[model samples]
Target: MSIKVIVADDQEIARTGLRMILDAQEGIEVIGEAGDGGRAVELAQRLRPDVCLFDIRMPRVDGIQATRSLAGPGVADPIAVVVITTFDLDEYVYAALQAGARGFLLKDAGPALLSQAVRAAAGGDALIAPSITARLLSAFAGAGRSAPPAQPVEALTGREEQILAAVARGRTNSEIAEEFHISLSTVKSHIASLMTKLGVRNRVEIAMWAYETNRVRT
Candidate 1:
């Protein structure tokens, strides 16, 4: 089945480019396009695409707000959102992540990465642009808030701890599986267990928790 996607960007060219790239992929489809955030939300609710590709800046509404409405903490049924933006600022990345975006990508992140990100989001995984991943996550981890003395993780086994550390380092599930000489399904099982143990919604949140809890070596 094709992964249905909605492309929302104020720029016609950007939307067109994204549609072209996504549509050319075998297992992905560009189901809709919205020139503004308001319409993006409306279309998202109506069409219920597998993933929403949103640009940060838009007229009438903005991508972050749209993301919040569709996937924020308060949402009852959150849709996966992949924020696509021209900027790579940490603030933008942080805000989008806070708004519950499943993935983040710069406009020039290329067709391969863009497609990979969409697939990742649709598959209940998350990806952040590498250029901003470590810096933004680390900054968020160390940004002025007092770290908790330690996060209680007696539930996690040694293998789960290793997987969590790899996730915090931005390693993909496949990479983690290869690194640990485990199957991909085993990596996913460990991640699922880690999330349950750590009380995180997604891999991004798990990474944040690892950093904030001082679980990852800086």
Candidate 2:
């Protein structure tokens, strides 16, 4: 089945461009579009698309707030959100990430990457823009915090440690599998174990834990 998506941006031209790019891809479809954040939230709750593409700045409401409303920590049922923006600013990216967005992309990331990011979010993976990934995550790891990350109740095995580092460095599960000469299932097993031990929801949170503990430094 095609991955269903909702595009939310204040600009008609931007929404049109994104819809055109996504609609042209096989196995991907733009199911809806919203011109502002309030409508975006309403449509997302009603449609519950596979992925939501939101621009950061909008009238009446903003993308971050919309993201938070749909996928924030307090949400009972969180929808996957991929924040699309014209700006590459770290602060905006950080806020979006903290708001529980599954991925981030600059508007010019192009069709291939744009599609990849949508698929990644739908598949429970993350795809932050590489131009700002490391710097933004590293700084976010330490910013406005005075305490260390919660230590895992169970100790990390060597393999799990390796997986954590790889994820922290922005390596995908497929890449980690290849790097360790392990099967995809084994890689996922290690990732699952890591998530359980670290008490994280996904790879992004695992990466944050790694950075918070200085396992992967900038």
Candidate 3:
């Protein structure tokens, strides 16, 4: 099935550009567009698309607030949201994540990465900007507020540890496979094993634990 998406941005040009990019992909569709956060939230609640792409700054309400409304921890049925913004500051990234954004991408991350981020968010993965991920996660680790101290590393095998470290570094499955000279299925198996061992739901939580536990340095 084609992945349905909603584009929410105050600027018409931005929405159009994103739509063009997503529509060019064979298995993705842009179902709706909203110019403000309130409309974005309303449409999201109504349409229930697979993914919602939101800009940080919008009239009436902000993307963070909209994200929280749709995907916050308290929301019984949370929609996956990918926050697109011009800012790469740690505070903005952290705030968006806290608001339940599944992924973060800079506005200029290009169509390829933007599309990948949307698909990743929909698949319960994360696709943070490389620069942003390195800097922000490093700072979050240094702040020492995100993760608890490293517990026993568990019984993770060598391959699982390697995959977990790559995940912590924000490397996608394909990238990890390429880097390790392994097949995509093998990479996924390692990820599944790592997730089970670490007791995490998604890659974002794995990345968070990596930072908090000081396992993968920024």
lDDT ranking of the models: 2, 1, 3
Cα error of candidate 1 at position 76, Å: 2.5
lDDT by residue (tens digit), candidate 2, 119-180:
88888777776665676778777664667778997999988999998887777677788999
- Candidate 3 local lDDT, 1-218, one digit each (tens): 99999999999999999999999988999999999999999998899999999999899988989998998777998899998888677455666676788778889999889889988888767787776776776666535344454453477788877887888777888889999999988988877777677775457666766777677776
Q: Write the per-residue lDDT of candidate 1 for residues 1-218, one digit (tens) a residue.
A: 99999999998988999999999999999999999989999999999999999999899989999999999998998999999877666466667777889878889999999999999899888777666666667776745445552464557789988988888777778879899999999998988888777776788878877777777855
Whole-model lDDT per candidate: 0.84, 0.86, 0.82
At residue 32, what lDDT does model 1 achieve?
99
Candidate 1 Cα misplacement greater than 4 A, ranges: 142-150, 153-155
Taking every candidate in turn, the Cα RMSD to the unseen true structure, in Å, is: 2.2, 1.7, 2.8
Query: Measured by C-alpha RMSD in angstroms, how accurate is candidate 1?
Result: 2.2
User: Which order, best to worst by TM-score?
Assistant: 2, 1, 3
Clash pairs, candidate 1, are: none
TM-score for all models, in order of appearance: 0.89, 0.91, 0.82
Top candidate on lDDT is: 2
Best by TM-score: 2
